[model samples]
Structure formats: C-alpha cells, structure tokens
Target: MTRARLKLNTKQIRARQRAGAVRGLHKAVNHLHERSTAVAPIEETTLINSAVASVDEGALRAAVSYDTVYAVRQHEELTWRHDPGRQAKYLEGPLVEESAMMLELIRAQIRRSLR
Candidate 1:
C-alpha cells in the first residue's frame, strides 16, 4: 500500500489564522457595540456614536471604548429615567455575559481559515 503525503505551508496557514482571528474579533466588537447601544440610555446619540473597538494582536486583547466625556457618569448613575443620574449598564454587563461567545467566534474564524 502506498502512503499519500500532504503538503502544508505553515507560514500561509499562520497568516490565515491571524487574519481570521482579527476578523472574528472585529465582528465580536461590533456585536458588543450594537448590544451596548440597544441597552444604553440615549439622549442625543452621542454615546451610541462614540462606541469604538480596538484590537491588539500582540497582546491578544480587544476593547470597546465609550468615548464620550459623560460615559462614566452615565454608566455609574444610580437612577433610571427619573433622576438626573440615570444608571445605565451598557458596556460591562454585556461584555461579561458574551465573553465566551467572543472566544467561540475567534475559534470559528481560525477553523474557517484552516479550511
């Protein structure tokens, strides 16, 4: 019986994996942004528009920034729709809940790239 040999370019495979991971990170970030916006208390759309995502490949890290000046205030507020300080848990809650899904997304991307 003859054995079949398969050729694999390790460099190309690594590159594709990296690209796939980045793409997956981007998608996850966008999903987080959308979820944050949907749950956020909106006044003039500033916060919604301020939602931004960044990925650091070297560090293997991803983050979403609510760039508005009032982001902290809004998030930390104690009241909702009644008092001046409206407590809106926009970013943190969703991120924590969906963290596992983000990992799965990255894995899926890597799998696709390998294929």
Candidate 2:
C-alpha cells in the first residue's frame, strides 16, 4: 500500500479497535447487571464477578474521572494556554478515584444480595 493509504488504514484500524474495546466493556457491564438481577445462569454470576474484578483499576478511573460538568470551571481557568499533561493529571485522577469508590459500592451491593 502507498504511504497515505497505510496511514488511513492504521487510523481505521485504531477506530475499529476503540469501538470493539468499548463494546466489550459495555458487554461486561451488562453482564454484571444481568448476573446481579439473577437473569442469567448461576454459573454466569461467578464469571461476571470475575470479569468486573479483572477490569484494570487505572483504566476505569481514567474513564470516569474526567467529568466536564464538574471540572468546567477549572478547565476554563487554565485555558489561555492549557497544559494537556497537567489537565489530564488534574481532571482524570479524581474521576478515577470516584469511579473506584462507586465500583466498590456496587460490589458490596452484589455481595449483600447474594447472601
């Protein structure tokens, strides 16, 4: 393939990979929901718990911690010449912390229900 075509192909592949990763995460989330609700086989509950436990804590934190609504004012303050590195560090870190806490709450609820 030509150089330009190769770059285009790479971009397409990256996009597809991103979409597939998102779909997998969604499926995992849905599986947890189903298992918690007892909509699936009992054996699947173990699988769902395992899957949720296996999610990388760092990645989960990174995904949810960057809430625009909560951080809008902070973002605006630094916008004249924003540092992407600093922004990522500031905005993403706390979001990740909140996500971790929420995940723990969900896990606790699941545990309580199983009792």
Candidate 3:
C-alpha cells in the first residue's frame, strides 16, 4: 500500500477500536450496577422506614432545619456562582409562598395526629 493509504487505514482502525472499547466498558459498568442494587420488594419496607426515621419531627423541628438549608443555598450561590438547575428562582419566589401554604397543611396534620 502507498504510505498515505496505509496511514488512513491505521487511523480508521484506531477509531473503530476506541469505539468498541467504550461500548464494552459501558456494558460492564451497567451489568455491575444492575447486579449490585437489586433487592426483593419486601426490602423496600425497611428502606422506607429508614427514610422516615431521617425526617420524622414536629414543626418547630422543621423550622430549625431551615438554617442548614439556608446555609447550603447560600454556599451554592456564592461558591458555585451558578445554580445547579437555575432552580433558585423557583425556591426564592413561588416555592417560598407554596412552602408557607404547605406548613399550614402540615400543622393541621400535626394537630389531627395529636388528638
């Protein structure tokens, strides 16, 4: 083969091999992830119980929790200098009003639970 033709063929082979290697790597990663994260449906009950334990608390408890949230939001804005989802507008505006509405709903639930 001429030198130019040989170089072209080598470049084409290298590209094909790189593409195949990437596909193989993706398949291996997906297979391991699927195998490791699977569990029986009943295991979901314990998963939910753990999640509830993480959040079960009264309104005063929730209001105090806001401090951590505020700090995280501040850090994200100043340090990151960009919103991850540009979601700050939602949170700073309508979400605040919606949250107050939700708090009223939560207080009603707490009162009913106490009775």
Q: Each candidate's TM vs. the true structure? A: 0.78, 0.28, 0.29
Model 1's number of clashes is 0
Off by over 4 Å in 2: 1-8, 39-115
Which model is ahead, 1 or 3, in terms of lDDT?
1
If ranked by lDDT, best first, what sequence of candidates would result?
1, 2, 3
> Which one wins on TM-score?
1
The lDDT per prediction is: 0.79, 0.38, 0.34
Residue 71 error, candidate 1, Å: 0.5
lDDT of 1 by residue, 1-115 (tens): 9999999889998899888888888778877877777777678878878888888877667888888888898887757562243237778878888889877888898899888
Give candidate 1 regions above 4 Å deviation: 1-7, 57-60, 80-87
Error of 3 at 20 (Å): 0.3
40-104 per-residue lDDT for model 2 (tens digits): 11232342233221344336321222223334454335444432333323333433444555455
lDDT for predicted candidate 1 compared with the true structure = 0.79
The candidates, ranked best first by TM-score, are 1, 3, 2
RMSD of each: 3.2, 19.2, 24.4
